[model samples]
Target: MSTSSGFSFPGRWRATFHQRDLAVFQRVADRHWPGAEPVLPRLSRSANHGLLWFGAAAGMAALGSSARSRRAALRGIASLAVASAAINTVGKGAVRRERPIVDLVPVMRQLKRQPFTTSFPSGHAASAAAFATGVALESKGWGAVVAPVAAAVAASRVYTGVHYPSDVVAGAALGIGAAFALRGVVPTRGQLPPPGRPPADAPALTAGEDLVVVVNRESGSATAAAAVIRDALPLASTVECAPADLPGCLEKAARQGKALGVCGGDGTVNMAAAVAATHGVPLAVFPGGTLNHFAYDLGIETVHDTVTALTSGDAVRVDLGRFRPGPQGPEGADGYFLNAFSLGVYPELVRTRERWAPRIGGWPAGVLAAFEALRGSRPLTAEVQGRERPLWLLFVGNGLFRRVGPAPGRRHNLADGLLDVRAVHGGRTPGLRLLAAAIAGPLTRSPVHAAVRRRKVRLSGLTPGTPYAYDGEVASSGTELTIDKLPEALTVYCPMPA
Candidate 1:
């Protein structure tokens, strides 16, 4: 029976594999597993349409403290989607094996309503493994917490006599592979390094001496971040203050310390930068707030990141985005933006969110604000550069921001010395127009949205008391405005490549 492939008994080999798989399935069905009797069957049912994993993902996004956790949740869901698509369209049809017979299995272990689909591969097992693997790829701690549950879900497929041992194993392998494939296409944050600019000179403060850190009491994970700062940089002085007092605290610290360190969100970092630039001190950022965009973009996700840079004197000179008439509207007054400045419904959304955040919380406040701000808002009429235009939103970034997936773009080169400007065109439904702009991203030039890059931009014709937002803080726009970049204005501490 030897063929060109050198196979003697392909049919017999397959038969033997099936026999082993059936035997293992029968043993799992026949065994009197403790606690699994009431748990495994229901657990299997919960994962029928991938509801359980979706719920788990939502929980991670809602309850997890930091952006990394939210990213892990998103990655997990994406991986699950890939694995499910593969199972339905390719894997199942490739090998249309029948569901295993439950003749020897206990009645209680059997599913109430058996799956009618062909059962070559267990979709539940694939989804479980994929979600867990994707989450672990982003965050190891959350992965460890999820691995046991994913394994249990896979095992339940066999224990309940629906899938053969081989089916579950193959499904899990496919799921893990799907997660890695997704990562390959959309690289993780760790995969990309911060922008490099030939590393500027800074004082290597061993033990973080002469560094003063100001931590906002209301920032997310403030307590834990302060503890880490204390433990990692014991010699660094820390000032804990309310959100209202951050400006003064940061200014005083910038004047007193060799380097000013800040632990808060983008708004806090913006204030810190203004003071740091004025005082000519390097800045160390600890990401201790919700959506710490500035710190994350700078490659400083935690206290350890800043500590490493501090000990090594590794720093970079980054561009600062600035606008005229500052917060004061006085002559020669100006303000700086570390992340972005925006006009239109977005600033209104920020204003609403801030007003209600203390009452309901950040995430809920944002959702409420989105609805409240966009409910009946009309397009803002403004003069751009030298022309009049009606726009729903005009976004200005410190540097060119590249869209990662769909929205909230990231900057790879922070010192590119250009303003990333995106304007959503005025339309009947501003909400839809804004969404289209987000999806259309930085390259789009449509009736709904447009994007451009420049060294500076001038805007005018704003109605009196028209509000604008920069780095999550809202302010009234002056009659005329100038937005530009200060190239390499602020020295920031960041990790040097190993």
Candidate 2:
């Protein structure tokens, strides 16, 4: 399953040897530093996701009964090989930066017998990304989903002393480029159709004349939000409903001729914003979620104070998250996510946190939820924008941290067009790092942490039943996942501070 200085081990010994090597690594850690402790390697912690993806693909390959399917699988493998060579061999070598570990300890030899390769872009990361890309091209559904795993794996290499975080990033970029370039050469036998264009006969609205509010009862926002809505805009009509009913509500309101106001979680807001955009209406949001990431991004932290300004909130154009689920079975079930659509630890945390919310209320729930997640954590394959690599954790945002809030002092501006991504190579300490990052003051930024900001995120193969939630709602329960940003789509109640 793995090689130790060029000697292949039996599959059964892989696990045992891995443990032994890890033990050796720890001992090495101790020998190198007697009193002080070396920070935990994030890469090692996230490796399981890579192994999981490999197994899943191999299993899928095994299920091929027809010669055509077998041939397709073989071609996919070949594509992966080509991609690996391109990203890892060509791209990484071209970016010849030294690994952070080598920079830190130049005397230390690579743990394993690797080539005398340059370390600017991580080769392992590049290879994993290329492989994920190749897989995505062949089997869009699972392949697209597994891109996250590739990212996770790539990230782990950096965290584990094999490369620099930047190296992983470059490798991912290379992998994605290779995957896209190779798409013409690969066969996607089970590709899914795209989410079609919005129906031609959608709603219409006059921005200043009237307002329509679309709310999801499932968002579980505070009862106070409704009152805030009623007082905020007397002309704004409320349509407390689900996503499916959003378009209808918009259409009905358009007939009545109203603009829009959306007060709920990101999903609810996303639906409302979409309808508002379709109908040419200015939109307003009331902060309602536990995190209220969107609200924070928009610099509208308090709902009550900003209501009046929301009526005249700046109208800005933004992008949207789009997906055409790969060819797996049927057509026309493509979906999109507002805020984030994550796999691996993120979805698991959402599910676990929701289940425990009733028993452990408030911040306590978050604490318990994180504990549960850590107890059963694993690596994930992921692709962002187009970079292929495995990662332990990934968060994609509508805009970069700097862009989402007022950059002056502590505030961030939300209108800029970029996605903020964060991931940690597998490690024990990164958990603490994450906690610290979460609790840190507004002005603080953590560069030592793992993160990337891009336009899109695609992930797959963390679990057979990957439960992803968007804006805190369970969007789907399958392996494939895609997350894109809807930029400046919602003009929330964001007023310049007094």
Candidate 3:
């Protein structure tokens, strides 16, 4: 006892904590809760290698009707991955805590396969907490559902005598920390502002009177979004149709309805905008596509946003880009583009993706198309402003697009009345050139990249059968195409900022 006369206080404190931790572990091992033998042990076993959480993620992605649900599931998985990595590699090695002796614990409650790894912070607890926290951060209802499971998983570690209460607590803390850290880097979707919009005169839909919603069956827009519209606006007519029938349905809806709504991607929105404009009807957009560029830019990310607008009659006038002779009307260009018009390999990529999308899925087909478009495709040679040039990509946006946070492309003002044109000069490497153009955006004029705001651009000298794309729809524009803008040509319903 007299050997170390001047022992540090911190050292003594640590020793005391170790004793308390062991005492708590023994108590947990001695205690028995009825009905725990059948569930928690199996639950912990199922979560041994993050299988349960992955299964939960898959279920959410498959069954959840909204984009937020899908995003929540993805965020949960990401947080879990981060937490698992931290605890297994860093936390375990740092602490070097020995596993609690399970002598006093019942054989029935004990795990079938005892873990061999060091357990200072429980990996299962960490993953559970992280996933639940992540999901909760994105979607509260899902988080509420997942939180109980996470708590159960954490408690099970202590109940089965595999980990001390302190270990489970530490793991959960670390998991929550990891999830918050991720949030710090990327702001929550809810935090993003739905920007300023100049309101336009639009009729308030009384229980969706004279409102017709056209849902594209092939666009992969969420079915739940369509269902929400049907419920929110009981009197609204709903049409879920194939791509071949989309244009016809849209036209019919435009002719009959006082207002037209679309629940699809930018391409589908493009057709709806044209039809609505041609028929003199306001448009409501429900974001259901792979990328709802126009809807996102308009601050309409959910069915709720559109429903609120429809009920309130709040709206805005936005520009639509066009190829020459767009949706023939009083103020239109070849076909209208609500988001972007592109030339070069992008068209081929769209063509390929569309061709295979029915066989495979949308995202997978996109991946396959990207490989085909990049690997086997050649640069497009076209006449731009009377100068012949080889181009990797020629992009024209309906309005000036600006990048904000996670969105690589977004427009602050949809009625800017100018074409956002960007061209990537082609040489040895087309990919690099396109990347450069994308990064430079509307603020550069380098050797391989250039961007400008233009009233119109005359394009020609393309191969006779060369393809081009506008608003996600691919078409052959022969050897000539005129890129132009029709500013404030379309009126769309969007909720006015509070």
* The candidate that achieves the highest TM-score relative to the unseen native structure: 1
Compose the digit string of candidate 1's lDDT tens values, residues 27-74.
787778999999999999999888999999999988776677898999
Backbone clash total for model 1 is 0
| TM-score result, candidate 2 | 0.47
* Clashes (N, CA, C under 3 Å) per candidate: 0, 50, 7
How big is the positional error of residue 77 in model 1, measured in Å on the Cα after superposition? Answer: 1.2
**For model 3, where is the 10-residue window of minimal lDDT?**
1-10
For candidate 2, write residues 121-224 as lDDT tens digits. 55566556766766655555556566766666664464345654555676677766666666554323323221111212212232323656666554545345
Q: What Cα-based lDDT does every candidate model obtain?
A: 0.87, 0.52, 0.82
Q: Give the range where candidate 1 is weakest over 10 consecutive residues by summed lDDT.
A: 1-10
Clashing pairs in 3: 221-288, 323-334, 324-334, 325-334, 326-333, 326-334, 326-335
Across residues 276-319, which tens digit of lDDT does each residue of candidate 3 receive?
88887899898888878788778786888898998989999988
How far off is residue 399 in model 2, in Å? 1.0
- Misplaced by over 4 Å in model 3 are 1-10, 215-228, 239-249, 287-291, 325-333, 385-387, 400-410, 418-422, 427-458
Report lDDT (Cα) of residue 131, candidate 3: 97
